[model samples]
Target: MMHGLAETTTGALTLEHIGRRFGETLALDDVSFSIRHGEIICLVGQSGCGKSSLLRIIAGVDTADSGRVLLGKTEVAGPDRFVEPEERNIGFVFQDYALFPHLTVEENVAFGLKKLPRHEARERAAAVIARIGIETLARRYPHMLSGGEQQRVALARALAPKPRILLMDEPFSNLDRGLRERVREETTATLRALGTTVIMVTHDPEEALSAGDRVVLMQKGRIVQIATGYEIYDRPNSLYAAEFFCPLNKLPGVYRNGRVETALGAFPAGLNLPEGGQALACIRPQAFRLAQPGEGMSARVVRCSFLGEIEQLAIKVEGVEGTLHMRTTERIEVKPGDDVRLVIEPGGVLAFPQA
Candidate 1:
């Protein structure tokens, strides 16, 4: 299990059999993953899924009851030994951009560098401030800055420490949607320029997919899938993995003879299923293409809504229990009760067999 020097650029982090619990709740369960050096990975999951707990464990701020955490070649935490947070070469950015209220922006960024000589600390702070383009606001207090400006100051402070690994906990949650997008892009660029190995925890699936080089998706207390945005979304390991990225149109059926037959059509299971097992043909909303009458399953349009670039339709297919949602860029001429035909895209049908 030796990753070469190229793979261990900044330093590798390996977690083996990490587990944590709080009274009646299992916060983490046998979590294990390896983070490559200089990689910006997202630890993504819903609330209560242990993403934050895992980040804290990696930073050595929290201890795991059972596991081994290795940073570089050094064992930071294990049953035999534990390293304190200060001893771990980790930098952290809290969700609220925790800046010192009373201290000026420059002083706050230089706070961690105080261990060095006074002259060297001041030089490092000035260099980071200039790099972050926040030198204009150096003397200003936290309250004098806007949300975005304060975030920049916080980032400057984190970068000033020159930590081997940076752990960010929902760093953009406080900003509005528009600002979040802009700030996220800015932060990504900054981190890339610095070549810092980062593991960011986020609850937003879209954000995780877009921001991270690799996305580690979690459910309950363990990882469900880990891959790039396209890989996880296009080749999900299960129905749960598929639905997490986008809305799904589920068509239930029985799996047999290597196929799952549904109201729309039959799809290849691609894997063996239990005999007569309950299965679902999961399709994306954008998968449905309009076909001529008599060519495919006939459906009557019950609802249609026009978005800016795409149109959404709710159609009731014959023998189907619920309205099927479809998105298309083609012009829509049909209204309520208008009969239409629909077909599934070859790439869209995913069959998941349930035990």
Candidate 2:
């Protein structure tokens, strides 16, 4: 519907061997990844995992100790060259929405267009404000705007300049959970309509998985994996990557004849572990479904908790120690001490080499 979606330009962003250090801490280590033009990338990791630090380096706010960053064929940062943040044609939306307190929404949006004529800057500001559907707040100052309104204003200001790339660091984190979800949907739609290339940093896995075209998962200053939401969740590269995105029911087992046999069932060992090696079958909570009596592994419902659309369940199976957590969206008619049968839904089972 929007013509802007087809207006993606050339100039893929490429990072080569980027590394940074702070005192004794290695913040970023040889981090290398490429983003296609107009692609939305989300950097996700735990605190101190270098996601934010990598973003700063890409925006030219923080310099890398080694390696180079290339926009298309032009080098932005390297051993021989360094570009200032403003001159890099990159827009940054900080987590706190850094709007000028003394200026109105329109004025704040127009501040970045200082190089243009006064009328032209005002026109661009008004056009961006209208496009983002926040023109009604043009005359209002930051103090008078709500958290969501301020976030919209910040986005409008960032997009006003029509930069080559946009970087956001947890832009929706300040709002309430419901508001955050709404704003995220709105922002994603707006970015897609404008065909803006974006690199967003988020600590929340749901935000990362939902909003990103591709997710970059990092751990301890190193990149763990890079893939689409489905691939990252279903075909994780490591145990850390698997557990980072969702909770897994790790069942201990032994690898034999290309399968890991656990007390629950046998799962294809996706790893290349030697025969008779220690392995684990990682099953997601939603992987278990209700089965008819005596059809699958027998499990006892230890507890059942209603969680709106999805129900959380603690199940106990014979020959396996500890309670296995399960989640289901179906209106399962069960309670504690009820006998139940659970069948493992195909594709939710993954085998990993035990550490």
Candidate 3:
């Protein structure tokens, strides 16, 4: 939980000890979590980490090998209980923005509301179209609309039934980067305005951190951590978790007292390692500050490339094991083989026991 972001006391969705396997590979192992009403939770991980498998189980498209899933008072999945996909009232927006080319935008939107009268369904679709600001696209077919328009139609169809919850599996992966950002903003605003409870699955860490109220990070079919973006990025539970978000420079040494010696010189790392105990100091690239030649830790620039507002560089320090990767916005007249210096901020270093 994060301050200023109050989760609903009422459990909107809950997964208890969920497990699934594909042949010899475990897809999900003992995964459990609770979601509050109107909350947006992102399930994020690397490829083949079982994020999609978990989403399928939650959507009722696939069955879990173990444990239970509940939405409000409805027992959606359990050892002895199972609910069909349609009956669960979960709206899924697929990665491809699955829309019907044969149907008009209005017809597509109305498809999910078939339980309502034909007239009532059209009315609901029209209202949702207006809400999506795509009323003008109501009569257009999927091919007649742009990528963003088609996505809006898909989203409109999903929301037409006023589902208990919405499940989006990388819904924005299809569009171009620019269009994706715009559509994401629009979709997020609409979901929040309608107070919809959403559980989305994506492999992109940036998307998970930017759009989720809480991020559920998965690794090898197991949840490593679940927290707000800030907490997960800054206070990772493990080295694996830390490296998942960004690259880290590892410095190996032995710890004695409270410091870990590294190529960059020793700084305080509160690890209580006995003398001669192994330790590894981890530092993020952005933590390095540029300094005048010989004024700070010495290094030789091996590579530099301008990246819009910042420059990406690879530098080699005398005692560091590998080339250090860093990104900085500071203007520096340096190229390959140029001597450079950098200083690590006080809190930039984190020491852990050598694995």
Candidate 4:
């Protein structure tokens, strides 16, 4: 509720060899990571990738099958002990908001502060509601408010108790596109202002890249990579990690010297591979740009589609099977069966060992 209520640097969290299982399925496989006192990290992956399960384990709602979780040197979930969710001082905002339809916004926010006196809880709720600029919605019920309003109320309720660590499970998935962006920006700013330690799970790659200070990418119940958004996007550790952030155009070739030699052209092998070993060049659509007819790789435009701010071109290049897609904002006057030359842009290509 206050500007610096969560400013204390006492809520550092660490997870060591954490594992979870649902019957025969392995949900999390030796997952491990840590969070700073007031840092914001985003957990991103495909559905059932154990992102939500990991969050539940950290929140003490679900038990870890193996390993331990430490919050400021205290083991919250481990072999020797297990702390209940209420005692962990962790706040969770579920995917659906989970606001009670029967209660008004004010009452819902005050719900978490029941430990305080009734009057004091109401006062705290009011202050948070006003702080989020949602005072007018205090008396309105959940069913009467828009999706964005409900999301704000959910965030207010979570922040009401000033929990040491806040876990949000797809908190912005329910809002429309424009509103989701606006609310995400506002919520991120609010949380940063409060200096709250946050772990937010998101399925959207763009959201994860833009919102998080660092992105933790998980796959098949294991962490594939953990790095800042830019590092993860530009320097992915594996082919899976590269494909996760964006659709990639894979060019099969052989690694020679420091480049992968394909029929079309040679591209820098970002990763190390044995000489003459098979390598796959993972190039994003934006990496292919239009060049003068004879200056770059020769290609024929198969199709072009206007997509609002940008245009998508499906082009055919010699020695490359199928059509390679390219996206650009330039207004290229091209159509099906048109001749074109394309150049590979620097820094948009990632090389990996061919599977």
lDDT of 3 at 111: 89
What's the TM for model 3? 0.94
Clashing pairs in 2: none
lDDT top scorer: 2
TM-score of each predicted structure versus truth = 0.92, 0.95, 0.94, 0.95
Q: Comparing candidate 2 with candidate 3, which one achieves the higher lDDT?
A: 2
lDDT of 3 by residue, 1-355 (tens): 2122223344788888999988999999999999999999989999988888988998899999998888875677887677899999999998888798898898889988878888898888899999999979988899988888888888999999999899998988888988988888889889999999998898777888888899999999999999999898887877887888878888897787688887787867766667878998888888899976678888899999998888888999997777998888887779999988789875766677789
Error of 1 at 225 (Å): 1.4
Cα displacement (angstroms), candidate 4, residue 213, comes to 0.7
Global fold similarity of model 1 (TM-score)? 0.92
lDDT of 2 at 192: 88
Off by over 4 Å in 1: 1-11, 331-334
Total colliding residue pairs, candidate 1: 0
The CA lDDT at 204 in model 1 is: 90
Q: Any runs in candidate 3 off by more than 4 Å, and if so which?
A: 1-10, 270-275
**lDDT of model 3, residue 117:** 82
CA-only RMSD, every prediction: 3.4, 4.9, 4.6, 4.3
Error of 2 at 208 (Å): 1.3
Sort all candidates by TM-score, best to worst: 4, 2, 3, 1
- Superposed Cα deviation of residue 199, candidate 3 (Å): 1.2
